[model samples]
Every structure is written in C-alpha cells, then in structure tokens.
Target: MASETIPITVEFTGGLEMLFADQRKHSLSVPAKDERGQAVTVGWLVHYLCVEVMKDPRKEMFVLDGHVRPGILVLINDADWELEGEASYALQARDNILFVSTLHGG
Candidate 1:
C-alpha cells in the first residue's frame, strides 16, 4: 500500500523569498514518511525545498551543513518551530511552515 501524502504550505519572507522567484508562499505535498519509514519532519521539508521547490542555485542560503542556516527563523502553524520541536516536528496535513530570513544585503 502507498502511504498518504501530507499537504502543507511553505512561505518565505524577510529576503529569503528571492531564492523562490520572489514568491513567498507555495503549496505542496510530501510523502508522510522518509525512506527509513519515519514521519517526515521539518528537516525533511527543508531538504525537499532545496531539491524540489527552490529553483535558484542559492541552496546554501536556505540550508547549511544539512540544517537550516543560522539567522533564519522558522514558524510552524503560526508558532515558533522551537516550541514545536524544531526540525523534528512532524509535518501534518495543511500545516503552514514559514521561513523568514534575518540576513541583510544581497
């Protein structure tokens, strides 16, 4: 049987939207589990963004060393991702994930 996909909304702001063609919000779906059969978390979503969604070559601006780069803020369903377990937060249907960049300049 095939696992159901989880639909979620992704948004970027505070300059990070530049990497996504200046489109701040995107709606997409992802598998419910990873290849290891674990629930897809924010970390997985980050990788998905780099590999699938984002068209620009500046992946390092969104991820660094396998994680969301510092100076960037992530919010889950309107709450800080830290409170939702950060990267380990399991994605849910219709969940809204937002990434805001704090860095300045080009």
Candidate 2:
C-alpha cells in the first residue's frame, strides 16, 4: 500500500459557513495502513462523509427545505448527484467536490 493526497471541497448552507470554515478545503492523505494495519481508500472517505452528514441534526433542513422534502444537492467534482450515483463517482488522486445546499435564502 502507498500514500496519496485527496483534495475535497465542502460546501455549506448559506450562513452555515462558520460551521465548516476550518474544513472548507482540505488535502487529506490516505495512509497505507491504519493503527490496525488496514488500507484506506477514497470510498471509505465518501462513506464517512455520508454518515457524518446524516449525523447532524441540521441535515434535515437541507432535505425538508423548510416545508417540502426535495432532495439536497451533493456535488462531486462539479456534478450534482443526490442518489447512489454520487457515491459511485470516481475520485481521482486530486479531485474536488462542492457540497452545495440547493435551497435559496430570502
């Protein structure tokens, strides 16, 4: 196993920038082995993101849109895919994904 850097862009809802300011743009390296000597890959990172998003209570707001339940946008490398397609998107060694909130603010 080898180590490589993966670039990611995390988009936030309007006025929610402060929440993710520290992690707006990051270049994380997937180590060859974890503490238990397990290999890490981009797929693992994507799964982690999905889990994390759902863990936050605010995530409901994105889906509900204050009234209706329209799907939210999770762009991967500038492509919007709210279904399984989003996860299937191949992640390059250096790719960027902008997780934008689809709802508009007044």
Candidate 3:
C-alpha cells in the first residue's frame, strides 16, 4: 500500500536559509517507510554537513576547513539536538526542524 505524504518544516542556520528553502521545494528522493508498512516520502538528508562536524572531536580542526562553515546548531523543533542526542533522534511526521548558527566574535 502507498503511504500518505507527510509535511515537515526544515530550517537552516546562518546563510543556509535560501539553500534549505530551495531544497524543500524540489526535495531529493529518500526511501522511507511509514507506520502501515507503506513507502513514504521523508525528503532528503540535507543536514549531512552538520553530521560531518559532529564526527570530529577536534572541532577547531574541522572548523578550519571551509566545509564546516559557520552557525553550528541544528534543532528539531525548538530543542537543539546537540544538547539532546544529535542525529540519532528519529524524525516523525509533521516535525518542525530548525537549524541555527552560533555567533562568537572578538
């Protein structure tokens, strides 16, 4: 049986707002299954960039690279996952995910 299309909100940090918006409009394909053993659309995992940052313990080292970028906060709803459990948190239908950058300058 086919699954219903679930709507989800995705927010990006820093200058990624435009990129995230574009991503939502023409989302990439992803294989997801719903509650009833049916296939569903859950959009693409556009936050891989953040995941890469999390992988390294020496944050300063990774930060030096251009891929890391600024604004290092990604939240599921109002809760920042880094404080919660990072990407291990499972996404549900109609979830509002927000990503924001942390600012620090001298």
lDDT of 2 at 31: 39
Estimate candidate 2's alpha-carbon lDDT, on a 0 to 1 scale: 0.47
| Worst-scoring 10-residue span by lDDT in model 1 | 1-10
Clashes per prediction?
0, 0, 1
Q: Residue by residue across 1-106, what tens digits does model 1's lDDT show?
A: 3777988999999999989999999999899989888999999999989999999998999899998999999999989999999999999999999999999675
Model 2, 1-106: lDDT tens digits are 3444454545555434333443455454433443454543334554455445444445454334332135445666666654435444545555565555445565
Q: Which clashing pairs does model 1 show?
A: none
Q: Candidate 2, which segments miss by more than 4 Å at Cα?
A: 1-5, 13-18, 21-24, 30-47, 50-70, 82-84
The alpha-carbon deviation from the true structure for residue 91 of candidate 2, after best TM-score superposition, in angstroms, is 1.6
Q: Could you say which candidate leads in lDDT? A: 1
The deviation in Å at residue 31 for candidate 3 is 5.6
lDDT of every model, 2 decimals? 0.93, 0.47, 0.46
What is candidate 3's CA lDDT for residue 47? 36
Better of 1 and 3 by TM-score: 1
* Model 3: colliding residue pairs: 71-101
Off by over 4 Å in 1: 1-3
